[model samples]
Target: MISAAGLLVQQRALAGRDYRLIGHSGARAAFSLGRWRIALEVLLWAVLALVLAAPLLALVASSLVPAYGVPLNFNTISLSAYAEILFRQSITLTALKNSLILASAAALGLLTVTVPAAYLLTRRKGALANLIAILIEIPYALPGIVLAVAFILTFAAPLPVVGLSLYGTIWIILAAYFSSFLAVSLKPVLSAFLQMDPALEEAARLAGAGFFRRMRDVLLPLVAPAAGASVILVFLIAANELTVSALLWSAGTQTLGVAIFNLDDSGSSDLASALSVLVVILVIALMAALEYLAKHLPEGVLPWRN
Candidate 1:
């Protein structure tokens, strides 16, 4: 009995009502999802505070206390622990110096080797390069303890020509570090090279730039940021290194990690805690520096950034 116009009008009214319902449901679903995301973010922050911030606060507090078991209070707190580690303890100073030297040496030394090796590995692209890459990675892939043992076995004897022994010496530790961290130092430079256009180097070559000239002029400038990042990464890891240094360290060769362990073992827990706090501070400062440098470096050069 209805006219066609009236029927069309009725259908349009139903469609509008259905659309309103759908719009309301969608808004509700979006609101619910937003609430869940906020809740998850809050939970994540809470967990980080509980796990990371709490321990760090406790460590700082413990380091301030005069002794390991002393209760932390305004009256009981003192800077003696820090002073003792910084000025009073000769062993601690030695350990600090050794750690710095090793870290710097390892970082710079690895850069020289990794830069050329990474260049070759990146540009060559063949089965031989792949095999060499795998070989370089094997030392790092092995457990620190395993690699340390392997080094000890390999260098326990005196050299044939030099007639000098590396076992139980800093040289041996440096060698182990070279092997263990070769991969770490290589990765950033390799990433930089991979991202680079090959045409730039080719153009330089066509212009009669020799290998060293090209590397010094073209390649080095391009990869400097990544190389710096690699150096920092290697320095950070080597400075705090424990496992490899533990087995290789002899008299007067204690690294920071070894010093911390030795201090705790010898019942100088307060000193150990103080040293640990300093190490933490150093690490935080370096990370902040790296974060600031991240803006200038290429994407993905610093893994922690994004």
Candidate 2:
């Protein structure tokens, strides 16, 4: 009834359809599992995004509004609050300056203290080393308020030799920051040390490199990425910290945290909201920078990256 060529073409078409329709049961099950996992992953991401973004969006919206009770609308939105923070508030500027200075100092100081200490701890392991490590971490393990109180008590009195009281001073805050965050700053560097190859340092030592020379030429270069991470981490934490600074801040030494708290406490929620928005911007920028640097950094340097 049909030509041979037409019969052959019809048979080929049916074969193609059969091939498309047919698949192993295992393959179908795998595809279903893959789709399910993707859906779950997407759902998790959505929840996380909502949780993180809601408060930030609320703060930004509040900052844009002129008053606390005013709803965000076309007529209510204003930039006056931001202007007040930037132009009218000298206290805000002073707090920003002090926070920057203290954070920078703390980061540098932590790097100076933690790098060598990490190297020593990694190179030498003994009961004494373990004890020292625990002692160093003890303050950080304690609550920040406890450490703040301890600092206040310890430095409230004038030093016998210098006769200078550090309490109620920026120095006292710095001291507290150092004690509270030293362990935090040490973590990345210590991880770096654990991952580093000892043969490289040993090779340098055998080749007439002295302690300082080997450290400079061999060890520092390897550990630099982690050190950078430590500095940034400490800087961010110290800059935005409230708990320790709240207790230690004197009249002139009010930090950003104290400033924000004071602004809210004084019933100037609008100004506080504006300042908080700026702080959120700053934190976002720093995190973005860190994310950008994550590719260049060591694997474990960023705890959240993985």
lDDT of 2 at 3: 34
User: lDDT for model 1, on a 0 to 1 scale?
Assistant: 0.85
Q: State the lDDT of candidate 2 residue by residue for 141-251, as single tens digits.
A: 677788899998999999889999998789999989999889889988887787776788999999999999999999999888888888888888888999989999999
Instruction: Go through the candidates in order and give each one's C-alpha lDDT.
Output: 0.85, 0.84
Candidate 2 backbone clash number: 0
TM-score of 1: 0.87
> What's the count of clashing pairs in each model shown?
0, 0
Candidate 1, 123-184: lDDT as tens digits:
78666875677677777767789889989998999988999999978999999999999989
User: Deviation in angstroms for 289 in model 2?
Assistant: 2.3
TM-score of each: 0.87, 0.86
Give candidate 1's error at residue 71 in angstroms.
1.7
Candidate 2 accuracy as TM-score: 0.86
Worst 10 residues of 2 by lDDT: 16-25
